[model samples]
Target: MPDSRDRKARKRDLTPEQREKRQARRREKRHASPEVRFILDNNTRVPVDLRPYSLNWDAARIGDPSYYVIGLAKGGSTLMHELVRSLCEAAGRTYIDVPAALFDQGVEPARAVLDPDWLRSRDGSVFGGFRWLHPWMDNLALHERRKIVMVRDPRDILTSLYFSHAYSHVAPETGRLADTFDEQRTQARAQSIDDYVAGPVSLRVFRNYCHLLALTRMPDFRSYRYEDVIFEKRQWIRDLAADLDIRCPEDRLDAIADAHDRQPEAEDASNHVRQVAPGDHVRKLKPETIDLLNRRFAPVLAEFGYGTAS
Candidate 1:
């Protein structure tokens, strides 16, 4: 029942070896959980149980459970993350991003949330983050939670993925998870977005998209369209807030949306307010690539009420 400040002070009193031991144990628990792996393998749905080791990262029950927002990598997750964080802060709750442990391997330090101490500190706060995989649902069964899946036009997702890699810090050498495109990623970086879309990069995006779509089969999952997140920001924010039980003023919600709104002209990947346009795929994709996407992603596009590329 100690205050956060007291917890921090006490944590600081621990010996370096003790801290290292705790960290090692946390890493072990994340990797060694058979139940989590089993649920993931079976694609287990609602009314599941979350393992205590995964939930109580620090062996203390001080952190709040997460309300997750999951989606494909380039599927407007950043914008949704910004809006969610703002609402959480406004509602006096802490917001946590995706922990690297939730991923299968090779987590970048900046995005990793596996630290036992950090996860425990957000007690009574909201946990928000993206999961590229479906098995992550297992980790949430232990707490009260809601999930939001962000969907984007597959063609646009490919376009953004190309630009995100070409312009941003994400690259094979940067420890990105694009192992499938390793051979061609460097060449694709120098090539035009159009060419990238026609090459291995396109396949990478397609495979990732399909991977995420497979999770839709699981029950109790709700989704947000990337286009809705961009154009219908206010309504989306309001609805999401209601779903997560975080009440915020409409004006405040609008302000947060405006602040995080995507700039259609933003070419800077590092800039949070990146290009916000829907259908950039039309401009950047070749006719053949467009055909391929329409054919390959037809089911998802149809299910989400998205028309094929022009």
Candidate 2:
């Protein structure tokens, strides 16, 4: 009659022999190529190159013309990017997608579009900067810059991240970023949703969620929910356009909203775009896992108004 949390604790208290037996069963379920998992778990593999995201920050100007769409990973930042880009087009401005790895201190700004000064030089163009962190806005700033920060229910964010990593971790043909981190081995070795929630990726995401919540409190940034963006694209666009001083004609804003109004796709068992509906974690996560996350991220949930964790 023990609940899942109690059962999980009981398993952890098993004797040595029983522990070995449990591990043996886990090995039987794992489908990874042996060598890669060994290297990843043991830290023997070469590190994946993430240098492509080097953020060589430059000096800020007083009147630099730029706008930023900032959000956590899998938190509708991509959709925010598209919405901002569409606004730029409607306003006769150029949309510049900033690279994720722009923090590298030494590299020169090779691309003209990435240079804030170069962007300033071009008339009728706006820098549509998309990044996760707030400090990224410091160096690229001008007096006229605007920032739109997006947030999502952390439960949905966690669920989406799990599926994304789940696909990336085990499926080699999918060519996912998870493969880069684990060499495509970890998920095949995953035992359950409980294990996945406690995995390295989820822990990192938790840290980021905490960090992002703190950053969101800073002044001069407009925040919106992922739900609002999904259910109210037109009003969201209008609000964003107004903040950025972009005079998006009513028809153009409607057209952009209509273009993005396609319902969440249904065939995405991979959960790609299929069910962007919120609260996916309710179905995908076990009771114990939810309790664990609730305890760990209680502050973040309360900070963002997702309701206080008990």
TM-score for each candidate, following the candidate numbering = 0.64, 0.63
What is candidate 1's lDDT per residue for 1-310, written digit by digit as tens? 8999999998999999989899767755543332322222224321212332133223323333445566666778767766877787677654545433333333332233232333333344445556354333343442344456788887887777776665553444333344534644566568877677767656666666675665566655578788866788878889888877777788898898788765656456655345778888887677877887788778778888899747
**What is the RMSD of candidate 2?**
21.2
Each prediction's Cα lDDT score?
0.60, 0.57
Report RMSD (Å) for each prediction in the order shown.
11.7, 21.2
Model 1 residue runs over 4 Å out of place are 1-66, 100-125, 134-145, 170-185, 190-192, 264-274
TM-score (C-alpha, index-matched) for candidate 1? 0.64
Highest lDDT model number:
1
Q: With candidate 1 superimposed using the best TM-score fit, by how many Å does residue 146's alpha carbon deviate from the native? A: 2.2
